[model samples]
Target: QFVLPDANLGVIAFIRLAGIKADQLLKNCPKEYWVPGLTYMSEWSHQWLDYVTRTSGRLTKSVRFCDLGDFKMSMLEREVTRRDGEAMGVMEDCYPQLLQTVFLCNASSWIQVPWRLLRPIMPKRVTSKFEIISPETNVHERKMLLQYIDEENLPTRFGGKNAVWPVHFPLPEN
Candidate 1:
């Protein structure tokens, strides 16, 4: 995932996620490294928060675009889910209310199973912010996402003109 260079409406950050084989990539790591891995993610989250605060303002928040275009069932293994839960917990602990919305794009019907199980467990504050977009409603959801994020800030893959990932730019100052 990477943040867009420009903030949405000058205050909201646009974070884009590219679908990747995350489970395969991390499943081989030993359990001993998990803590350090979460720490690294925390540090990265701080950098992003700092960037938004500096570029926009202290009140700036984020909107995440989770593109599951290449997602597979194997990616939802127990280990991956556990790691993800830990990382999310850390983020919430470190920066509450930093996320304004989460757009789950290109989601298949398989997602409903997990969403059903997860939704009841998640706080209303968190669950209410999520917006899932399936293949059937891609066009409509794209319009919805555009309502919050300007077309210029969105990446080409998400119906915007920005083709480059923000990683190619500079990292936020520590």
Candidate 2:
């Protein structure tokens, strides 16, 4: 459910595939498929920037790269550190300025290992950006998401009153 919750607050939800072989997730996504999607993001971000200019609105933009299937760290690392890693370089290089907040969801602490590995390799500008996912927050996750998004727009897994999840992709093969 990638949405600009309000015109004033351009919030988007981009769900990354988790708990899968890294190659299938990004490394092996065909160039034809990969290139266009990257192009779309570049275009869409420019649109968002233009909207900001016209509206004179200040917003906190966020990207949620969810670990929906509870991916393990080993799988997570390949997507970020591997040289042929598709989205990794693009995200770190291209997407930084457009976003103010980023978070990872449903992933475990194994994130630390890969994060540490990638941290040294990334430039200061990239390294400064942080993705926070806190399950231990005082408020529940469902309530937290609902605070910004109306219940009707949220995925059911987030305790949304409307809309089932898997809105984009179908069930993964075991």
Candidate 2 lDDT score at position 127: 65
Give the per-residue lDDT of model 2 (tens digit) for 44-85.
654665575467645444544353445654554543344335
Candidate 1 worst ten-residue window by lDDT:
8-17
Clashing pairs in 1: none
Off by over 4 Å in 2: 19-22, 25-28, 59-62, 77-96, 112-128, 135-152, 156-163, 167-174
Deviation (Å) of 32 in candidate 1: 3.2
* lDDT (Cα, tens digit) per residue for candidate 1, span 22-91: 6555766766677567667556655566666776665555666777666667656677668768777877
Reference-based lDDT, residue 9, model 1: 35
Predictions: Cα RMSD each: 4.4, 7.0
